[model samples]
Target: MSARVPRVLAIAGTDPTGGAGQHADLKSIAAMGGYGMSAVTALVAQNTEGVRSVHVPPADFLTAQLDAVSDDVEIDAVKIGMLGSVPVIEAVAGWLGRHRPPVVVLDPVMVATSGGRLLEPDAEDALRAVLGLADLVTPNLQELAVLAGDALASSWEEALAQGHRVAREHGTLVLVKGGHLAGDRTPDALVGPESPEPLVAFDGARVPTDNSHGTGCSLSSALATLQVRHGDWARSLRIARGWLRGALERSAELEVGHGSGPVHHFHHVQEALETWGTVPERFSDELWEVSAPVRREIEELEFVRRLGDGGLEPERFLAYLDQDLQYLDGYSRALAALAARAPAEEARSFFAAGAVSCTETEAQLHRARLRHAGLEGAGAPAGEVTRRYTTFLLAATAAEPYPVGLAAVLPCYWVYADVGRHLQELARRSDAAAHPYADWLATYADEGFQEATRTARRLLDQAARDAGPAVRERMREVFLEACALERDFFAAPAAASRLPGVVAIEYS
Candidate 1:
């Protein structure tokens, strides 16, 4: 017999557009790997833009719906959203008092994204009272302000302050969302009275998009599902936030409506179809195949080609080498983290050796090259590209599971080996001139490097083979992203030198 999955129920209103309310909650719950059930409190006549009207179900019927779900089904978690009126909030609150689920996430959905009021003004008191039943409450700045009985938060600090007040007053955990803040990064924090600082904080680089209509609903529901699945709030929040960020990043690809569209919950599935055309029979064999474009771009780079034939400028080569050393600092940390998280002793030892190689072997190679170039004790500062790439790698290793983290760091070893071998072959065909980059090319083409690359591939393949479909798909995404970043890393010096004045703006 199959094991039972966590059953998550959403007690919320309906959005006909399917972008918010019960629709979004159910979609989010299922997307986060839960069996979702819903008890509708109201029917919202709305689209992606805003709500036009809401039709409230009778308090007694809402109670009946709650009883119907609790009577037969065992609910692992519950997400409560958009209590339309005092009667409805009271009914749901009363139900919560009796049938207390293991996890209760209340999304205090008051003001909509488009500045429409979702709950009645009088129901604010009822909502406040309802918070006692919730283990966690997710509230954006506006909702947080209302819950705190304060004006709209003018800053992120104010929002966090409001969240603390509400959490302390209700004796519940509060997730303060910073998406509404006008900034490049969206930071969320989990606050409770048990700690002076936030219990947990997830800082995310904001995906600049208008398709954030149902983000509040989705986050709360996803947290509920993940809570049921993992039973750890911090870990669940990290995974949920990662999934949400990915959804927001790809939301623009969806053309749901003219207004702010709903987030693409299944973007990963759509992406695989768009990218691979037909799903590869084996992801392991086709890993490098999928990265063909990046490899081609790297091969065609002027600096790369010139280095192969010993025609690259010494200054440019020195700059690349210095930036590489800076990158190694972060890379070494990522490798060490991967080693610590590896399930098998083989993987653990391999990644641990990799970490040592970066700090010791690679460091010696870089210092020798810099000294040969008459640049001893002189190093180039970390460029924007190097920082961005290394930052992504470090974050991936820290936030993701061992398998996902392994996928992220694999491309650096494999891609460099492939590029080095190609360059080494090109250098061999050319006349035996004393090339400035000869040592660099030789190191990459070395048998030890090749062996390391092979080991990386084997580890990734084993992990992918053992992982479930969802994790395997995540591995594909991290692999693809890391490969793309590897190409960017190779082409960084050229891009920066070529476009000295022009800034490159990357969204994801």
Candidate 2:
């Protein structure tokens, strides 16, 4: 009855301590929603105390494991943790070239929590051999220093410098985790030229806890999940960091291993499973009723048929968009929150794309605002319109869907595309001489708006294709609700009730 999910594979050393390596990666992956597969490089003998010994797997055995996973299951993305030995590293590197999964996330685990070396001294060369093949490589302060070679990371500035260097040198993005930096906020820098500026700094509230045994593995695995599911770097890093923070917060009180404890990977899932038949997601009946009304209007309206006729108009369309953009911005923020709560990489990436989508829509709305001609007053609409839209956003923000929370944003995209096309006849016939009227044509006529609309259509199509029929249906309901709200706002029954002019502000 549940939907099919993305698949992810994790390859790395095993930390029996459960704090730092492949175990952390797998746990992070599953918490996100993707089916998880794994290949072991080595085994660690340790607990909450320290690593006593390590049993490095044979290079041939490592190959067989990688082959077994990649040969059988469809691995959407991959996260690599510690290799433990030169042979292990080489084995993984060789398989990486052969499989070439969509995304490869690497956590360059050269050192451990107790200041021990998980990688052999000569293993650095082997690690570098495969570093360039990754989509991303995550490194902490010490590992970064080692990977960058001797003189490259003598100071914090040098460490930051090496992060950029690593990405450029390897043709792979690098996430330089700055949790070790003495600061009030823990910041991790996502570096790659394809992204904005020098880096996208992901900041998280620093939780003072020593249970961070497998943090490197956890973070990289989380990022890999996002990259695999969403294909966005900045979004992935942002979500991955948030998920790791949540695990740290919740697992702070848990004590399992003697050395470093594992995160509470299934906290939310376990809670729900415990409460399973007794209590479903809150307000189930209400969701059905609230969702149904919008669907009814959509079914009755021939929106999709009109879109096929190419008769869609612009100004009226733009009016609905301003509110929708506002809504998307809030949805993106919610995705960020959901990502924070992710227990695994696959789950984090799911929301990561939503965040990217949020900003993408916001950008279009910003461009549309320029057409509003000056802070020139256009007469205010009713207070209720503003209140309603704001209320919708606030409600989503407070919801607990977490990574899956991105689902809330789906309604706007699919519904609008469906409804807009249907109103093509109205769009062409409507008078363009009025206030919102002139604004609508101007907004839709612009190249940016056209492109934005196309993107929304494409994204929604992708979602429909990827999501299960049930989830798709839910998304459709949400989209219909948004369309209904737009209709209500634009088709205000009383023309005399129109308030004062709205002053349009220029975009910066």
Candidate 3:
């Protein structure tokens, strides 16, 4: 999972109704867990009913706003909407060419939802030129036709063709939306420059609502933010579409104006805060509850159950131990990196101690176990799962913020403690003295390790409290990702045991 909170800038017009343009862009950016900034190109006196008038700011002033943000902050992504005129469009294009933010999503806003023209007639060619600079272009059917220099598409196939043409001509991704078509299902396709056909398509049920006032602006901004967060176009599109769909489904709840109203931008966030409360005390509980399925899956693994019952083959057990030793080497380094970045002395001490424990204490235990099993000089290469998990940890610790690194490493301590306790109880219920993995279970389930887990949980909760909404969201995402990787680590040995001709594991 990507760790940092993306800083996204929206250069667009504004709606006093807060349903479209920069207002909607900022809302979508925040809803998608990004720090949002804005530079207004035009201020429109508009409502859900229609645009009364638009006041364009001078292009130089717009440039000033963009410069102010870029000079101070490192922009991770940019969302462009409603440029209004050729000069304003050129001003934005110039800034984009200069800064070249990592991701750029352009929403070609030609006409408003209430049938008001927002862009000047002579600016169509300029908007086309701007399309070449964007990473992704989100254009509704009407806007797509205008940019393609073709008639309005009456069918989905026609729309996709136009999308491909624009993508091919501009060398960028085009998001073609089907909301303007007459249908029960609303489909959206992502057309890329490399293919004549759409690279991906999402078919969703038409949401029954009249309050989808700024869906284009909202979705474009969401794409910009999510692209920065995930760094995969398909995954970003899927997440962005899911979020927009939810907002659209709940749009009528706002009831803001007489005509079409704004979608409820904070619907999911509101629900999450209500359930978890404003305090950080419930954060750990939330992580545990959300990861209950993974915990259950770990308990049900064939390797775990067999080990608890003294039925796992000796060769497989040794292989698992070898993988664990290899994993710990990388894990210890990640822990030391976290200690180096920790703000408080207590946290630094705790993580530093953990690194020492991983390298010295765990290493001794694994070596002693291997020597007892008559494999004193044997060690296996790290398997695919082990390599991937350790690489993720090292990358998170080295590249992400301190809080994000903390979240990434917390699952290793917490999940092991929980699973250890369960295994110890299972061994106790059924002949603990005969259980082959009794020593390993006791090591993880011991009171000292349990205390360490509690301490880590406490530190993470405090970190979440200190972080803003965007960073907190990022921490949660990283935690969940780490939990899934933990489950995969436990499952790998069992999966390997099922393969043919794999009776005796090889050691180097």
Best by lDDT: 3
The residue-level lDDT of candidate 2 at 185 comes to 66
Model 3 C-alpha lDDT per residue in residues 57-175, reported as the tens digit of each score: 89999999999999999999999999999999999989988999999999999999888999999999999988999999999999999999999999999999999999999999999
Ranked by TM-score from best down, the candidates are 3, 1, 2
Q: Residue 177's C-alpha lDDT in candidate 1?
A: 91
Which residue window of length 10 is worst by lDDT in model 3? Answer: 498-507
Q: Model 2 over residues 1-508: C-alpha lDDT tens digits?
A: 1244657888877776566677777788877776777888888776667768888867999899889887788788888887878778778878887888888888888878766678888878888878898878888877777777755354556666778777777887888787676666677887773532446776667887767777777777877777766677888777777677878778855667655576776665665566443432322233335656665555454432232233333332333344345545555776567566555565566556657866875545554563453322222332365447545544543462321233344444444443444444455665543333433334445455455445534444443444454665555455445556644544432122322233231110
lDDT of 2: 0.62
- Give Cα-based local distance difference scores for all models: 0.84, 0.62, 0.88
Displacement of the residue 371 alpha carbon in candidate 2, Å: 68
90 Cα displacement, candidate 2 (Å) = 1.8
Q: In model 3, what is the error at residue 76, expressed in angstroms?
A: 1.0
- Name the lDDT of candidate 1: 0.84
User: Which residue runs of candidate 3 sit more than 4 Å off their true CA positions?
Assistant: 278-508
